[model samples]
Target: MTGHTKAHTMVGKSSQSLPKRILHSGVILYVALAFLALIYIMPFIIQVATSFKTDADATANPVSLIPQVWTTAAYSKLFLNSDFPVWFKNSFIVTIVVTVGRVFFDSLAGYALSRLQFRGRDIIFAMLVAVMSVPMVVLLIPKFLIIKSLGIYDSYAGMILPLLIDASGVFIMKNFFESIPRSVEEQAMIDRAGTFRIFWQIVLPMARPALVTISILSFQGSWNELSHFIVSTQSSSLTTLTKGVASLASGQLSSGNQYPVKLAAAVVMTIPVAVLFFIFQKRIMNSSEGSVKE
Candidate 1:
């Protein structure tokens, strides 16, 4: 009887301590995540703060997150006194066209590769996979050569056409299509729907998550593309935000280092991409959840 009573007392002590242990662990985890988040976000925060600082103050206190004297000179210069609007216009046009083209072409190729069984289909897919493995830097020279040979160099067509079909986007869509039930397409076929009809009306709508993913990726890639723009076009009017900002950083706009203007340009360039991601984040999460369930 005494031993049983002692055992029960120890069990009570363990139960009482369990909540405290859990609370301690939760606190530690929260702190760790908070620190990590801060670390990742600190650079962006500094960029914004520095954008509001005067050029002299920004250079003087480069490491400081808080500005000594806030000013809108950087913004005024970018919007009022520079070629920023033209750069922004070029970026927007290229990004929009590229995103739309990629979504449509990638989906088409993906569906064909995933569902069709033509001769040499395997060979074609293998080639695509191999192409994806090739680094973008390795293709820069070849890309330039091809753009020149095609007589589209130093033009908008040179910039937009080459990036329209991404191998990775095609791969992503193909994989997503394969996960969908074959019966879905088979049933549409039985209803006498044409291949294009089924793909466009039925399968495409069902693949919203994948489409959104590709759209976001294409938009971001084309918006931030610098090397391609550099090789394809030489005109200042054709320059995108990335190239224009790079010039700004290299002292094109001023004699001394204009840190505020450069940082402001950086911050503005980030807003479009950030907004795009946030808008599609829910769709991405939902698609992930659906994939998990499937």
Candidate 2:
């Protein structure tokens, strides 16, 4: 009876302390994370505040959290004088096409690698892994050479085709494909469905999470890509937001330092990605969760 009483007393004590310990740990973690978040967000906060300041104010108090004198001259110049509209259009067009192309092509290739049986399959997979590891910066000159030789320079093809199939997207799709149970495909095969039909109809629908991941990555990458667009095209017609903003930053249009114009451009360029993030946020979260579960 004493032993039972002692065991029950210890269990009661532990139960009472568990909540307190968890609460203490949670508070400590929250404080640390909040501090880090503030540190990271401070620069962007300053950029936004300073963007509203006049040229004189901006120059004198660059680090000020609030503008002494606010002005809309920068935004007016961006809209009225610059080719910001053209840059925005190019970014939108390229981002959409690249995102769709990558999702479809990469997923197809990945599905083939995961399921298809043919000679040289293992070799192809190994080559893809090797290709993915190759540094992107190193390929800049080579890609330029290829684009020039193909006679596609200054054309949309030069900009789009080279980025249509990325190795990282292929890898992500392959991983997601592998996570799926083989029995699903086995049943489809028993039905004597064509391989492409089974892959397109059955497998692709189940790959929404991986597809969203590839789409987001591709959109962001192509939208923010400056160097590739620089090498691929010379005309202002094809200049993307990144390239145009870079030119604005380096004083292409303005003779002197224009903090408001540059900061507004930066903020404008960030809006599309921000919208994409929020729109697909739930899907992204669920996708990550599903990946973890797998």
Candidate 3:
């Protein structure tokens, strides 16, 4: 009887301790995640803080969050006293065009690959996957030569056309389209709907999440692009935000380091894409969800 009582007491102790152990583990996990989140966001926080600081303060206390003298000189210079507006206009134009084109083209290509029967479909997809593996840097010279040879260098066409559709965008669309059930299309076909009609009326509507995801990625990619702009265009009038901000980095438009101005430009460059990401954050992740409806 004494031994049995002791065993029961030990069992009771373990049962009581289990909840405490789980709580302890949960606390540690949350702490680690919070710490990592803080580290990741620190640079963006610093950029925003430095944008409001005076040039001297930015240079001296570069890492500090608090500005010794907060001023709007940097923002004022960019908005009123510089070509920042022109750069913004150019980037907006290009980003809009590219985003729209990529979504339309990617969706079409993705649907074709997912649903349409063709002879070289597999080979084409394999080539696209292979192209994705090749570094963009390696293709810079060839891209520049082609743009020049096509007589579109230093023009908006050169900048926007080549970036209209990408392999990854097509790949993403294809995967999402595949997740959709064929019964949907088969029913449409029984109703005497044409292929294009079925795709437009049914498949595309069901792909709202993936389409939004494509728009976000395309907008962000085109907005942040620099190298392609460098190799494709040269005129100051055609400068995008990425190229203009890069010029700021090299002190081309300022006397001193002007960290504030540079960071301010960087901040402005970030806002649109950040807003887009936050707006569609949920949809971007599970874009292919519910594709196979019962």
Which candidate's lDDT is highest? 3
| Per-residue lDDT value at 243 in model 1 | 97
lDDT of each: 0.91, 0.87, 0.93
Candidate 1 per-residue lDDT, tens place, 269-292, comes to 999999999888877624443243
Q: Write candidate 2's Cα lDDT for 61-140 as tens digits.
A: 99898888778777788888999999898888888899899999999999999988899999998999999888888889
Model 3, which residues run further than 4 Å from truth?
1-25
Clash count for each candidate, listed in order shown? 0, 0, 0
Positional deviation of residue 222's Cα in model 1 after best superposition, in angstroms: 0.8
After aligning candidate 2 to the native by TM-score, how far in Å is the CA of 206 from where it should be? 0.6
Q: Rank the candidates by lDDT, best first.
A: 3, 1, 2
Residue ranges of candidate 2 with Cα displaced over 4 Å: 1-23, 285-294
Greater-lDDT candidate between 2 and 3: 3
Question: What are the models' TM-scores?
Answer: 0.91, 0.88, 0.92
- lDDT at position 43, candidate 1: 93
Tell me how far the alpha carbon of residue 44 in candidate 1 is from the true structure, in angstroms, after superposition: 0.3
lDDT of 2: 0.87
lDDT of 3: 0.93
